[model samples]
Target: MELLQLQYFLVVARLEHVTEAARSLHVTQSSLSKTIGRLEEDLGVPLFDRVGRKLRLNEYGNKFLHRAERALFELEQGKQELRDLSSPEQGTLELAVTAASALPHILREFRKKRPHVQFHVQMLATQEMVKLLHQGDVDVCLSSPAVEEEDIECQVVYNDPILVAVPKGHRLAERTSVSLTELKDESFIGVKRGYGTRDLADRICKSVGFEPKYVYEGDEPARLSALVEAEIGIAFIPSTARNSRDQIQYLQVENHELVREIALLWHKRRYISQTALEFREVVADYFKPLT
Candidate 1:
């Protein structure tokens, strides 16, 4: 019934381990167990199925988890709204980004305008970003293949064209454009599969009837350029991340509309702080020229 009880139960439901969850919650295991028991008693149903030291969310717990999350989300929004009212000029913006290439420019421009404002940036995969946004963990998300959840507001900020990057001496480097089918046999360097760009590239390649053979899969987009430059493999890269140095050549994707729609997403009903609004404006301004 108590807020603390709900909070504790949610944590236990997530971890599914009493000792681990209690350690993370910074409470004694017995105390955490007692709290969860009280919450289950209040609800008149057992939330979790117990097996020795481990716990698993039962059907009831799975159903209640969503409600608990929403309750906490609303409470957090209320707190943020009050904080924004008290300190309109200074606040931390929780930003999650899947489009890592564009983030530096956006943050730089935003910092120039609001030096007093701060940022907590998370480089997250598309699914993780969406999950956090729904949970109210992030204020906003810059994502690709925009999130389509009914409760989330997603607006396209930039239509970033995807291109193929190759080392200077590579045959594709001389071509101004190449089709996805042409790169079928080429060894590739790519970001990991979870990344927006990587997923998009895979889908586009699949559409053309082949999957790219990644010689090296990495986490950093910046490293893709380096890998291509070393002739380890060619890569599908966003136009915004095209390297200026002649060592790498960026070729347009011919016969396909290979573009990632970079989007800004936030919960439509969540309270938006003045600083967050300003930050959104900054993001819009930064991507305007690129679009």
Candidate 2:
């Protein structure tokens, strides 16, 4: 009926001698005899046949012995697994990140601190990251803000300044910084709608008092850089989107209020695992200066 009672019954069942079980169990023989009596009384069955001083298991007690042993073993194993999860030795940590946010520093530090954690990471857009988190496809995500939704928690990692990706021979390349108004006359290449880049592009155009005359729209960096090289148009992106060997050059926007905030996103229903929390602390410490 109770685990303690079952445990006492099991010890007596194994030894088949009340005195021997009591000695092994470190209890007085009278206390062990009384405990066995209580177990039998609670179960409404005589577990052992008492012949003189010897104890022998009845059929029901023999049948229940294996099941009781399995229950206790499983309980001990369950506790061990929980302890392993907290030990920082091994685990699967699933996460997603924005297509381009400079998180190499944080990732390097995380790997150094937790080498045993297997990381599953993907490059995704802000909206895509939100979708994955909601569907429970990932434990966490790094993203730029796009679609505002409920039940999704976001923490700002840092702000990345937007830089214009221009053709090397473009006239504005000589300028230290240029306003969005200066780009109204230039053909602007931009990311598609619903993406953070697209929103910022629209905001810049709006501030400069004219919408962009786009010649191309997509989310690929290499191809966009190639397009800029071919003299198609110029585009704006966060600094992380640069390709060092590309013919396109990144330019600063002076007196510009535009900035992209990189954030860590998670579902409200999901509890951050110990490894995830540790990595979060690492990122926070790494990016504190940028915030």
Candidate with best TM-score: 1
Worst 10 residues of 2 by lDDT: 72-81
TM-score of 2: 0.63
**What overall lDDT goes with each candidate model?**
0.88, 0.76
| Error at 35, model 1, angstroms | 3.8
TM-score of each: 0.87, 0.63
In model 2, what are the clashing residue pairs, if there are any? none
Writing each residue's lDDT as its tens digit, candidate 2 over 43-115 gives 7888788997698887978877888876765665466458556775786678887645456767888999998
RMSD values for the candidates in order, in angstroms, are: 2.7, 16.5
